[model samples]
Target: MDIDAWLWWLIGAAVLGIALVITAMPELGMLAVGAVAAASVSGIFGGGAVLQVVVFAVVSTALIAVVRPVAKRQRTQRPQHATGIDALKGRQAVVLERVDGSGGRIKLAGEVWSARALDPGHAFEVGQEVDVVEIEGATAIVM
Candidate 1:
C-alpha cells in the first residue's frame, strides 16, 4: 500500500516531536509545527512538492529566527523573586545593638545578623529600624 504525501508529512512531524521530547530542544518542536503546515499544504490545498517544501522551510526558519531570540531574552532577564541573602536586602531590620560602621547586630527577617552601617560616620541606636542595603560575607550593611 502507498502512503499519501500528507501522511508522510504527518509522520515526519511525529518524528520531530519525539526528538523534541527526547532532547528537550524547542527548535525541534518548531520544525514539527512546520511539518504540520506542510502536511496542510499538501492535503488541503493540493500543493506541489516544491510548494510544500517551501512552506516547511519558511515556517521553520521563521520560528527559529523570531521565537528563539525572544525566548533567550526572556530566559536571561533578571528573576523577579529573590532567594537566600538576596531576599534580605532592601528589607527593614531593627537594630538589636548599637550599629556603627565597624560592627553590630540586628534582627533581620526574624533572625539576628551581624551588621554594620553603610556610612562610617552614621550609626544606628538599639531598637531603631534600619534598611538593609546589602549582604557582605555573613554581614548585613544597613542604612
Candidate 2:
C-alpha cells in the first residue's frame, strides 16, 4: 500500500484505540488522541496539510470548550455542604457538663464535642438530653 494509505490505516487504528479507551475510562487524553487521528486522516486524504492542522486544532478546542463546562456543572451539582460538627445541628445530644456562661462538653453522634448554651443561665447536668441548635466554629450551641 502507499504511504498515504498506511497513514490512513494508522489513523484509523488510533481512532479505534481512543474510542475503546474512552468507553472504558473517559479521560481528557482520549479527546487529544481523537483530534490527532482526525488530523492524520485528513492529511492522508490529500486535503491541504494546513487544513488538517486546522481541523485538529478546532476539534481539540471545541472538545475542551464543551467538556469543561459539563464537568464543572457536574462537580457543582453534588452537595458537600456539612461535615463533622456542622452535621450535628438539629440532632439530640447528651450534655456532659454544665455550660457556665462559657462552654462545656457534650456527647453527640457517639463523639464528644465542645458545646455552649444558647440561653444564658440555662444549666445542664451530665446525661441531660439537649437539642443541638447550631454550630459556630469548633463549638456547638445546645438548647
Candidate 3:
C-alpha cells in the first residue's frame, strides 16, 4: 500500500507533539505546527515534497524567531507581588512576649509566630512592634 505525503507529515506532527509534551519544550510544539502546515500544503494544494519541506522550514524558523525572544523576556521578569513567607518579610510584628537572641513569641500578620531578634544583644519588649527580617523554617527572624 502507498502512503500519501500528507499522511507522513501528519504522523511526523503527532510525534513532534508527543516529544513537546514529554520534554516541556515550546520549540517542539512550533515544529509540530510547522509539520501541520506542511501536511496542509500536501493535502490541500497537492504540493511536491520540496515545496512541503520549504513550507515546514519557513514556518518553524519564523515561529522560533518571533516567539522565543518574547517568551524569554516574560520568563526573566519578576512577579509584581510577593506571596507566602516572602510577603511576611519586611512586615511589622508586635511582640507578644520579650523577644531576644534566644527566642520569643510575636503576633505577625494576625497570627502568632516564634520569633527571635536579629542581633543577640538587641531585645524587644512585649507590645513593641518589630520588623520581620526573614523566616527560618517555622521561626521568624525579627529586628
Candidate 4:
C-alpha cells in the first residue's frame, strides 16, 4: 500500500495539534503550526519531501529562537511589590516580652509573633514600640 507524503504531514499536524492542546505549551503549538505549513507545502505547492522537512525545521527553530527568550525574560522578572511576610518588614510592633537577640515575642500587625532584637545585647522592653527589620521563619527580627 502506498501512503502519500502529504497524508503523513497532515497526520503529523493533527497529532502535534492534539499534543499542543493537552500540554498547553506554546512551543508545541508552534511545532504544530510548522507541521501544518509542511502539509500545505507538500499538498498545495507539490513540494518534495526534503523541501517540506526544511520548511518545518526552519519555522519551528525560528519560533523557538524568537519566542523562548521573551518567555524566559517574563518569568525571571521580579514582582513590583513585596507580599506576605516581606510586607511586614519595617512595620511597627509593640514589644510583648523583654526582647533580646536570642528570643522574645511581640504584637506585630495586630497578631502575636515570635520576635528577636536586631542587635545582640540590645533589648526591647514591654510596652515599647519597635520596628520589624525582617521576618526569619516564625520569628520577627526587630529594632
Candidate 5:
C-alpha cells in the first residue's frame, strides 16, 4: 500500500484509540493522540525536513490553541457554583452549632461550613436562621 494510505490509517487508528482511552484515562490519551496525529500528518504530507518541521509546528500550535480554551472552559463550568468566600456573602444559612463572638459552624446548601459573627457580641444558636453578611478569608461572617 502507499505510504500516504498507511499514514492515514495510522492517524485514524490513533484517533480511535484516543477516543477509547479517553473514557478510561483522558490525560494520557489526549497526549498520545495529539502526538500521533502530528507525527502522522507531518510524515505524510511534509516534502522535506524543513516542511515537516513547519507542519508539525503548525499542527501543535493549533492543538494547543484549541484544546487549552476547551479545557479551561470545562474547568470553569464545573466550579461555577461558588468560589472564594466572597461568593457566600448575602446568602442565607442556618447555624449548625452555637456561635459565640468568635467562630462556629453553619449550614449552607445542606453542607455545614465554618462561620463567624460579623458584629461584635452577636451570638447564634444551633438551628437559628442567619444571613451571610461578609467573608473574612476562609470564614463566613453571619448575622
Candidate 6:
C-alpha cells in the first residue's frame, strides 16, 4: 500500500501522454515530457517529492512559454504562392456588359463579377475578352 513518488510521476506521464494523443495538444505533450523529467529526478537522483514537482513545473512552463510561440509562428506563416482572389489577377475574363472605367460586368472563373477598365479612357464591349489586372474589394480591374 506504499506507492513511490516516482510511480506517481510515471502514472502522471502516462495520463498526460493519453491527453496529448486524444487532444492533439502540444502543451500536453510538453507537460508529459516534464513529467518524465520529474520521474528521473525522483528515481535517478533520489530527489524529494517537492523537488520533483518543482522540476516538473519549471520544465512545463518553459516549454509552453518558449516553444509555443515559435510553433504558432511557424504554423501561421503564409504560403509562397498566392491563392483565392489573388490568383484571379492576370487571368482572362469575358466582358458580359460594356466595361468602362466606371463600372461593368464580366464572366470570370465561371462566375459573374463586377469589373472596371484599368485605363480611364479604355472600354471593353460585351463578348470581348480582357485580362484581369487586379481586384479591389468585389470589383475586378481589367485591361
Best model per TM-score: 1
Q: What is candidate 2's lDDT per residue for 90-120, written digit by digit as tens?
A: 9999988776448999988988889989987
Which scores higher on lDDT, 3 or 6? 3
Span of 10 residues, lowest total lDDT, candidate 2: 25-34
Q: Could you report the Cα RMSD, in angstroms, for every candidate shown? A: 1.7, 6.6, 3.1, 4.2, 7.4, 4.7
Q: Which stretches of candidate 4 lie over 4 Å from their true place?
A: 1-7, 17-29, 40-54, 73-87, 125-129
Q: What is the lDDT of residue 28 in candidate 6?
A: 96
Relative to the true structure, candidate 2 reaches a TM of 0.52
Ranking by TM-score: 1, 3, 4, 6, 2, 5
Instruction: Name the regions of candidate 2 deviating beyond 4 angstroms.
Output: 1-31, 39-58, 74-81, 134-138
lDDT to native, each model: 0.97, 0.72, 0.97, 0.90, 0.70, 0.95
Residue range 1-143, candidate 4, lDDT tens digits: 99978889888888988988888888987888788888889989999989999999998899889999999999999887888998899899999889998998899988999999999789999999999998999999999
Q: Would you give me the overall lDDT of model 6?
A: 0.95
- Runs of candidate 5 exceeding 4 Å displacement: 1-84
Residue-by-residue lDDT tens digits, candidate 1, 32-136: 999999999999999999999999999999999999999999999988899998999899999999999899999999999999999989999999999999999
List TM-scores for all candidates, in order: 0.88, 0.52, 0.73, 0.61, 0.40, 0.59
In model 4, what are the clashing residue pairs, if there are any? none
lDDT measured at residue 86 in model 4 versus the true structure, 0 to 100: 87
Which candidate has the top score in lDDT?
3
* Model 5 / residue 122 / CA error / Å: 1.6
| lDDT of candidate 3 over 1-143, digit per residue (tens) | 99999999999999999999999999999999999999999999999999999999999999999999999999999888999999999999999999999999999999999999999899999999999999999899999
